[model samples]
Target: MESSPLSALEQRLISHLQVLYPQTDAGELARQCLSALKLDAKTPSPQPHRNIWDQRDIMLITYGDTLRWDDHPPLETLHGFVKTRLSDAISVVHLLPFFPYSSDDGFSVMDYTTVNPSVGRWRHVSALAQDFKVMGDLVINHCSSRSRWFENYKAGVEPGASYFYEADPNADLSNVVRPRTSPLLREIQTQNGIKHVWCTFSHDQIDLNFENPAVLLEFLSIIYQYLEQGIRWFRLDAVAFLWKTPGTSCINLPNTHEIIRLLRLLIEHKAEDAVIITETNIPNRENLTYFGNANEAHLIYNFSLPPLLINTLVTGSCDHLKNWLMRMPPAQQGTTYLDFVASHDGVGLRPTEGLLTEWELDNLINTMKRFGGKVSSRTLPSGDIKPYEINISLWNALSGSVAKGPDQWQFARFMCAAGIQLALEGVPALYIHSLFGTENDHDRVEHTGQLRSINRHIWNMDDLEHALNTPTHHQKVFEAMVRLLKIRRGQPAFHPNATQYVLHMGDRLFAFWRQSLDRRQSLFAIFNISDEPQSFNLAELNLIATDEWTDLVSGQKHEDLLGKVTLMPYQFLWLANKVGKLSEPN
Candidate 1:
């Protein structure tokens, strides 16, 4: 009998494997990968090039246990909240690592196949998927030191005997780039002898050796299990550090990109609409490489946005923000950006490597420190410490400005940030704490002894519901965000891939124009970044003389293109030519 011809999926798998493991048998590895999928060879593969997202696709980033009730699991409570309060504003729920973990709040995953019982079971995740799109973390870079794989490695077992990246303790690993100050290698006693294994984030998190094909096959199985559990969006956490080399920086390596490509290929083949998002928190230019000609990551975190936007709001100037935005290239056809001002973690400074000056950075850092922010530092090759991220709640971080000190414009400043993010050329994600206008949890930070815990405040369901029902800053911020998000959902010009051009509205005013894909809707989003009121003539927008425009936020008509427009301290306006399809919230 003659051998069968290879399918398109198999051919793509072989190509990726050949690049990832040139010395190994690419064909056999491809067969094992296909076997991990447990799919029949005759199954017809769907074309995966279809657009999987659009303008109304807003995402909520939260821990599964962020909201809790007395007798119910946290995931069920989260599902209830999303169904009742957030169903109209957001379309996706990004559960930040519901898996059991040893440390780092779920990034150090102990088990890849099951949900943590403390949060909820797989049924709750599936339940969330029934009503809204769900996103899950892949945690691809490393595993918990307490994980089964690591234990097996210690016992010299079959699958994990050589599963970890081992390095000589005395080797010149000073060149390795990492985001943590922890020692790069940990001394562990294995079955054979004493070995020094890589530990990228912390000693509790052991880095995996992807050079072993078995390791790759194991994660493939995990991906298949996640897809079965209704997770269509995969966030590859710390993916840039997946591959390591002896003499290099050991980040953003070619083999790492190839592994991502392989994962992308396998995922697309299994589920056509599935998405892959890479969490590469590097400098602006280096972060862009994860796109890999639109074949690697379907979405990349707009890492530079958080630091740059915060600095703009605090320093009362948009020059740096505007310059950075102008330099940013629009994402390709099959890819887009994931934009957010705040998340479960802190506002990273590493992403602002070339965008901000030394003086500006020092000023911003000092301002944040004055506003109850804690600075987290990373180790350098030269044995110096540098600020890596600013750990604080978004609401608190905007409590004051660098020039004016503490002010009463905290609410308005945050709204300005949200409005600008909504109009940017990407899908906007709101952290659960950000939506609630949470302040820094100094108590939690004291309890957990983790800087990130400052922003990861947990809320009791009843107290949270009471707070929203009452008159408070949290209620005010939540209501304003909901109104803005509802309005954003209605606009076609706010599409993730819509045309965006930075407007030169002076340093005090930050402005941008977004046009719908069909060119029917044009929106001019402008914000006053300073604490003082700012005014600009509508003519600066160059509005079409024939088209009537209205301020989507204030509902003000603008027939005269030359009419002047004014924004209050830290206020924002969404002036649009046409209202989109979705109705405004009551």
Candidate 2:
């Protein structure tokens, strides 16, 4: 790229960079960014419109190597599969940590710029981008110890040595919040001397020091590279662990928020449609702080929703889930929740701290165990260890079955979760495993010894094609979910940013009402959380049959009749009726 003449806006951006890095030589860095983006001597691209994420912006989150064929690079196969099987249903595909990594299933990043050879090359990524918007994982909090940056730091390399955070071995770190119970600092033999460097995740994943302008500059470079690769959606992995400072919780600090805002600013300046979603698996209120006046993240993972939704299905009650949703603060104009039922990681428990009672949590835990799910723990600030997450496939987690084969109730239970996800007030995301009704991969877990492995199975192309083609649980769930999503995509009432009202139907029923942005379309989605039948009265909510209501899910016209409305075991109904009055339409 040529170092072209700078636009005034480009000059102003450079000045801001200079202010950000007062002593460092930021002129060249700024010029490089401007050149890389090819910003002409004119106004920058229009700032991304928030309207891009509506009913149609459904996302499919998966790994590059999740599907393999004939030893071909998995990314190629992933692109082919998504392009063929999921193109119309999904618009955005989040390729989780496709870069070269050492451990933690690609979380411990060894390289940032290049794709893992085993997965495929940049062309594969570009190929997927051609079909759907591609989201890249920016493992920003820490980098692999085996990375060149870390090795350079060990050799006392000027820029790299200054990139990592270091603290005295005797320094007090009690206030530092721990995501894992691992050691906070690791003693390393550096070229300069013995050093105790901060490593919040693991010795292999050394935390980067954002306090250093050099580190921030490097990060800016990496992000620009991703932008060059056509990735517009960037998920900051384990962001709460970023920007650590002494004597603080070291999570969601003001400095951390500021850094995120700065990055958001840079991205918006270059590409308006680019997005940043923060990954913070903490309590709901604290997790939302990433929004930072709607300037920090365009989306923050609704970490609370997964566990709360799971608890609702597990206990056959909506008390916990309803209470949580009712109390949720409204999302700001440009920010919204990324609601998901399951992910590569298991169901997180930390997000349910205040939402679920100890007894309820225990009941949920034991229920998961009965279904062959494994539990992983985290160290609390109080120095006590407790279950942090439940590691299980959505299939096994819901059906309480550990058999290698499908459960009889698999499709019903899975679709119930998906319906709830779609009916929510935000952009609903589906994990690849969850979409296929995949079951536990105990063999993978035993072989890799990573509990999360049970839910992270890479499929053989032939086996996967067979499963998806036949009338197996996987095919049934996939086809049903796609059908639901298709219906959801067309309904203005299911708009991601539309206004939602939680409807309290009854003990076994969970419901929410959605109104379109234009106020011309509306829907009342109701779910039976238990196996038992549940019924309600339309008169209770001023809704009536056939005259003013139609069931969207089953296409059943609600004929005028008795006030009682009934739902079968695990059945869900979506009703569209008169927006307000229950009088006859005519």
Residue 415 lDDT in candidate 1:
91
**What lDDT, from 0 to 1, does candidate 2 have?**
0.81
* Per-residue lDDT of candidate 2, residues 488-564 (tens digit): 77777877788889887766788988888888777888898876688887776665343567787887776654468
Question: TM-score for model 2?
Answer: 0.92
lDDT of 1 by residue, 514-572 (tens): 99989999999999999998999988788998888998998888888898877899988
- Tell me, what's the RMSD of every candidate? 1.5, 4.9
In candidate 1, which residue pairs clash? none
Alpha-carbon lDDT, every model:
0.90, 0.81
Give candidate 1's error at residue 249 in angstroms: 0.4
The residue-level lDDT of candidate 2 at 376 comes to 88
